[model samples]
Target: MFKYAKRLQYPINIKKKDINMAKQLITQYGGIYYKKDIKK
Candidate 1:
C-alpha cells in the first residue's frame, strides 16, 4: 500500500513541475503557450 501511494504521488509531483515549466515558457514567449484551436 505504501509503495502504491508513493507511485501515485510521484506522477502528481512531476505534473506539477511540468505545469510550472509550461507557465514559465508561456510567459517567456509573450504569454502564448499554444496556437488557437488547440485543446488545453
Candidate 2:
C-alpha cells in the first residue's frame, strides 16, 4: 500500500509520453510510494 506523504524528497516529472506510460505501469505494479523507507 502507498500512503500520501506531505511531500516527496524529489519530484516525479514524466515529460515523455512513452516514458510516462512506463512509469505508470511500474507504479501500478509495484506502486509509487516511499514504502516507509524514509527516516528509518
Candidate 3:
C-alpha cells in the first residue's frame, strides 16, 4: 500500500512512542535514520 503511494510526503508528524519504536528497529538492524518519504 505505502510503496504504491507515489505522492506521499513527510516529516510525517509521527508520535513519540512510534518514533521510539522505529529507533529501536533501526538500531537492531543497523539501519540509518531517514524521513519516511526519503530512500536510504
Candidate 4:
C-alpha cells in the first residue's frame, strides 16, 4: 500500500519503445491513480 508518491509512475522502458503503447498504458494507469488521488 502507498500513502503518497512524489512522481507519477509510467511504464518501464517506454521511452525507447512505441509511443502509442506508452500512451495507452499511461492513460490506463493514470486513471487509477487519478481516482485514488481524488479519494484521498
Q: How many clashes show up per model?
A: 0, 0, 0, 0
Model 4, TM vs. native:
0.36
lDDT of each: 0.55, 0.64, 0.59, 0.60
List TM-scores for all candidates, in order: 0.33, 0.36, 0.34, 0.36
Candidate 3 at 9: error in angstroms? 25
Candidate 2 local lDDT, 1-40, one digit each (tens): 9997798888899665785565566667767663443242
Off by over 4 Å in 4: 1-16, 32-40
Give candidate 3's error at residue 31 in angstroms.
6.8
In model 4, which range of ten residues has the least summed lDDT? 31-40
lDDT of 4 by residue, 9-33 (tens): 7654434767567556766878656
Off by over 4 Å in 2: 1-17, 33-40
The ten-residue window of minimal lDDT in model 2 covers: 31-40
RMSD (CA, Å), candidate 4 to true, equals 9.0
Ranking, lDDT, top scorer first: 2, 4, 3, 1
Clashes of 3: 0
What does candidate 1 score on TM?
0.33
State the displacement of the C-alpha of residue 3, model 1, in Å, after optimal TM-score superposition: 50
Instruction: Give stretches of model 1 more than 4 Å off.
Output: 1-17, 31-40
Residue 13 displacement in candidate 2 (angstroms): 26
